[model samples]
Target: MSLRTFKMVIAIVIGGFLIAGIYISVLVVERQGALRQISLYNPAWEAGQAASEFIRLEQRLSELGRPGSTVDRNEVELRYDILVGRAQILTEGRFQGLLERNPEHGATLRELQDRLAAIQPLVGELDRNPAAARQALDILRPLEGKLAQLASAAHNHGAALVQKDQQELVRLHWLFSGIAVSLILIGVVLILLLDRHNRLLTRAHQELHVLAHQDALTGLPNRVVLRERLEQGLAGLRAKGPSLAVAYLDLDHFKDVNDSFGHETGDELLKAVAERLRDCIPVDEGHTKNLISRFGGDEFAILQTGIRRPEESAALAARIVEALRAPFSVNGQEIFIGTSIGIALAQGGVTSSQILKHADMALYHAKADGRGTFRFFEPAMDEQLHARRLLEADLRKAMANGEFELHYQPQINLKANEITGFETLLRWHHPERGPIPPSEFIPVAEDTGLLSTLGEWILEQACREAAGWPRNIHVAVNLSPVQFRSRGLVQSVSRALAVSGLAPERLELEITESVLLQDNEATLSMLHQLRRLGVRIAMDDFGTGYSSLSYLRSFPFDKIKIDQSFVREMSQRADCAAIVQSVASLGANLGMPTVAEGIETEDQLRRIEAAGCTDAQGYYFGRPRPARDLVHTLAALRQPTEVA
Candidate 1:
């Protein structure tokens, strides 16, 4: 039963109990009042009976006082005394009992007691003289009148009590009837409300069940519901020998979408993608099914049964990718999202999980091959996925294990041939994988969100190591695009400077053009924040990306490093020399220091120095080395130079 139904039933039961209590209370009050009235009237009824008996005895005594009658005075006196004593006893017992129970009747009972006491004296007087019998008769006659009046009052009082008791009975019946009617009305109302509430509860429960099985954002079947559907598809494939295909779809660059736009727009884009995927798959003829579900954030899966061939599944996957390639307009921006689809065919006793894994592997390949594409699963993909997973796991533990180290490449003053600073390069020495190059692991770290921690570690280590170096040379560290986009990048830099006791003016953060391609405001804001910290900002790999001049004008960078590609071809190509010379002249005009990278020979260094480049770094000066090796090299360079 639903919670609402249970509550409704409890409410109805409580209402019934309340009505019953009210009815019982009313009955008890009426019954108690009737009992009190009966107690009051009983005394009056007993007094009336005693008074009538006294009148009858007095009349007998008057008849026996005639001259013709022989009278026994002692017997008459004894009988009269007996009558008076009986009357006294009855008056004191029953009337006093009534007065005790009903104090409101105390005055009437006392008056009756006084009258009975007067009758006792009169009876004693009659017993004393038979001649006084006539006088007594006369007194007894008026006494009889008074006794009759008392009897009449007693009868009236008894009648009044009976009338009161009848009224009380009527009131009790009315009260009980009203309570019964109220209880019936309440029961009916409760039953009606409970029935309505139960219906509403049932509807709500059904809706909740539907919602539970569905994705709240996209209205697609959720992971749990999709898993059940996939299992059923697998069962059918196993029993009927039909081919089933599962495709895992992942949105490429979805994080960029969420980062550039807000999450609300990202959610809208996901819902739009889900609708497109659902529309792409046609329903099967009869028993076979095509089911679409949202696996998780920007990840979706589809299960298609009764495929005659693997190529059909590939076609379906392609259609899903093509559908997602359409631009989604959300929040007044035309957002383009690409999807990579992975297809796995059901055969060779593939379980649900294995099929899903194969599809995911294909998706990974699709994404790696460039998004907006699809790939069919191959067995060897499992090896690549395993290796990737292992690499990710090791990367997570690399920082804590102290397996990472920095190498410094000295930047030189091209004209003076003096070392200006060193660029810090990160390297990981894995125990099992030997030395892992930055090219291989840096991208992985960026993709896996390990770059933030790795970047901070390198910064802190470089700052600390540079603090111990000679005061003339500055230390430069490369900031990955991931780290630059991090929320704590500025704070991390500030903390590194404070902790290492390294002056901010001596530290330079090298950032690529990709970091500036995001929100220009945020990027500029972060750049301005770092600039305010008194650290030199160098545009690394300059002229390699679009908007080289625009970037220079947007933010005031202290230095611009000419990419090695342009520097390497300066000896062979005149165009490379002209480009370097133009960039150097532009830097000089803008008051920004220009450094040419990858200067190998004295001739190339002279050419760059003649081009007005202030700084240069390459093998010509010194190769990247560890801190100890760089220290020895710095010490050697500080000695007197020997001209060859």
Candidate 2:
């Protein structure tokens, strides 16, 4: 039965038991009440008491009848009153009902009452006349035999009533005993049912536990099982001489397969991958000492034990990678996919969780170095990961702590020899570590999803600060590629302009070619939307990507900022100078001004200017400074000083 049905059955059984118990209790209460009513007045006892009282009264009257017998009148009166009281008791209440049931007993009691009533008048006169006692004695003497007979009949009736009650009590006792036995039998049946239910529950729990630990699609052990084996393997390594390794593998570009073909093909491919992974292990050591587990969604883990050398684990990883490189036929279609593996070898102090994390870190680096390869976890990777986490944590709190500041680097117009605008650069001054470079924290912000909030703040702050600047100069803020992929990029830019009351034309948004690399159409559409908002768009870090020129042709940017790397080496490298001249010429032909960045020295500045660059931004102009320091810095820059 289903669990709900089983529960309902148990509930019904318990309710039946409760009802039966209550019924039995009610039976017991009714039986006790009947017995109590029967016990309230014993017919035999009443009859016997009446007979005794009469005999005493008779004997007292006989004494008074004897000549010169000294009997206290009060004693005689008390005996008389007691006899009358007993007779009255027999004729009233429960006794009266019993007397009515037996007509002989009722008639005898009435006759005795009539005789006592007749002697009562003589007994009262006995105090005044001695002869009255004899008369009273004569009347009471005949009542003795009648009262004895009445008592004997009452005794017989009481015996019959008691025997009937005893028989009924015997029947009730048997009934109760049967009920008790039935209850015990019901309890046994309930216990057996409960035992059966418990067994079913236990079996179901075991099945559920297996399902919890096993991957449904691959039917292989999942991460939970992998972690368990890793713990066991690590324990064995600590106690024994051989070491173990955990390799975390992630399918590279698996999402493309799902998108291109379908998820069904992807699932079949994963199942096929699972089979190949099993084959990749040595036939003798399959799943006994080493375990392979799926970590869900294009990720899997392998635990290798009894390793004498690191090369052994490396060989296994290589075998798996090589095995997966061959295309698999899924749904009659040839599909090619590769895996990236990160291996972490067991050590004295390394735990299962830490080793797993280390492997994941290695996998990240492997993917970074280009996928379809494997890497070992190194100490430096752990250190760098730890530092990045610390920086991310600090970056989250930096906004609320008011530690973020906007620094604007003046973009110099080479033709006018005057300042054109400033590029809004974000700077973070950690309370303890001092200023953290944007290169260090920016990626952390992107990874932690703090970039949206940070990006919005940057846009607003840059616009607000630039709004206070001289109207002719504009402020340029570089947008992260992640910000473009995320929603609300357009809304954030619009809000920053609106909230700061800055003209959209004065706000220049810069993006690199990387933004267009992921979603080319979407990025261009976003650029168009930003352009419609009356803002100037620029391509920052120009000439960094192979498709930078094509991206410029796709969108009409107001300005192009030549990458600092090219400008820095333009003086030393002929190719760098030619590229700079070419980008400047290209920008001029497009009617877009090209700003040469990293112009530190006069010779580099002269080369870019000679190359027909429109604007230059670097140390040769001024270092990026806070908005508050810009006015004084600008005035100082306008005053020419002799070169040292």
Candidate 3:
């Protein structure tokens, strides 16, 4: 049956038991009253007491009748009162009822009462004259035998009443016993039902608690439970010496992995990583020495307690990083991912949020140092992070206030010795901080989701500026990786060309291998689409990234920009010169022009030019200048050749 119905039945049973108990109690009370009345009725003792008192009173009346005897009127009067009291007792209580049961006994009691009433008046007369007391005794003497017979009958009748009361009490006892048994059985069932309900309630509570605290995919503690655990641990160490450390860990290039693979693979990879992290720590019981949690995405946290020293924390962080170094096999393929950890130890008084913030700052610093490493917390990290946040806020507003401008660096042809193109570079002139380098603001732009907007603005402005330049001079603008991946890239490029009325042949888009690393197939497809638009595509920082040669075979790039690292060192290092020569030869054989970037000295330019470099651009040409200033420099350079 349903629980509600069962409860109703139990209630009804209990109510019935209550009613039965009440009925039993009332019956028991009634029986006890009958039993009490029967117990008090000792008909033989009362009748004998009345008869003995009458004989004693008769003896006293005879003494008063003795002639010349010492007259004792007081004794005679006391005996008369005693006899009257006893006679009244025989007529009262159960005795009268017992005597009525037998007609002979009842008639005998009535005749005795009439005889006593006749003697009372004579006794009162004898009290006034002692000689009259004998007359009262003579009247009661004949009825004494009738009174004795009545007493015997009363005694027999009382015995029957007592027997009847005992039988009723016995019946009540059996009925009460049955009711008590039913109540016991009901109580046992109710107790069992209540116990079962309590157990189910406990289990449901445990399940809800698990859902609240655990990560759905990884089965690790989520951020909410992690914070609660940290708070509890910190509270314990507050009064004592704090020997605790908090580590904030994040996977390097996780986004790249997610983009390259699928989200399903990413989720499986996270679960695998969580399991490895647990294995890396010491676990005596089910719980580890450290509480690990998936903070969010590829980010995780480890809350460590009972630390002996700060070095212990650093060692733990190192171990965690090395533990993740081993490749994880996901979907039957080996996927390598690195972990960067930031360690923050308790110093003085540290709250959970502050400790977490410090660890985050240290993690950012670790990334700044380079990924796949760990760093200890320091106060200066907060200051640097705060400055970065301020810069990011201002950078957001810079474009709106027109604080950004394009500087053109001339890319001069080695053979023609005239400016063929100018590479468009972005510069931010903050009103308060002065000029911010692209190195500083470009990463910030990418991180703040401002790259796409900044990229479109750069495209439009560069095209507009280059349109105003000499027709033979082309314009090259660097493209952020985010922009290339965006679906709006083709549309943005088309719009820029349309609005500026710049020839597509004179527009060059520079892309780094970072874009190629994200999704090669998609990146190649996008590059081909852009190539079909009739603009030139140059691979920027060509030799710095993986498979630089393989990428050239994947797409017929218009130009290969030799990385400045190889170009700047070519004059000093033979290896650098050999790399420069090989890249220049490769570009020539592929029917692509090679541009050696960052050429500052005559010797470096000569080395690249000897290596058959077709185009070069660096400080040796000229520093990037404003469009108006570039006109003067180009006019001076073209004085003799005049647009080649």
Candidate 1: lDDT of 386?
Answer: 76
lDDT of 2 by residue, 1-644 (tens): 88898888888778878977987897798679659756744867988888988888877877874778777788899999998899898888777766777787778888888888888888888879988878887777766787898888777877887777777777777777887887887788789889999999899999999899999999989988888888887776655477788899999889999999999999999999999998887534623367889989999988888775565677788898899999999998998999999988876779888998989999998899899999989874465467777887888889999999999888888767778799888889999999988866776687688988899999999998888888888999989988998868999999999999999998899998888898889889989999999999998999877698788779989999899899889868999999999999999999999999998899998999999999999987787888887852345675556121
lDDT (Cα atoms) of all candidates against the true structure: 0.79, 0.85, 0.82
lDDT string, candidate 1, 1-644, tens digits: 66766787777678787869876896988788787777667656666776766665666666666778665455556656665665565456545644465454455434544554555555567556556556545545545555555556666767877897988888888888887787787778778867877798789998999888988899888888877877887876655466788888889889999999989989988888877776887666333468888888989988888765454576677777777788888879998878888888776677888888888888888888988898878763355457778988998898889899999888877666677799998889999989998866886787688888888999999999999987778999988778867779999999999999999999999998888998879989999999999999999999987898999999989999999998988989999999999999999999999999998888988889888899988887766888877742434654445121
How do all models score by TM-score? 0.45, 0.46, 0.46
Residue ranges of candidate 3 with Cα displaced over 4 Å:
1-340, 344-381, 632-644
| Clash pairs (backbone) in predicted model 2 | none
> What digit string (tens of lDDT, one per residue) describes model 3 on residues 228-308?
978887777755454678899999988988998889899999999999988887542222267889977999998887764
Residue 323: error of model 3 in Å?
Answer: 9.5
Point out the higher-scoring one by lDDT: 1 or 3. Answer: 3
Clashing pairs in 1: none
Of 1 and 2, the candidate ranking higher by lDDT: 2
Cα TM-score of candidate 3 = 0.46
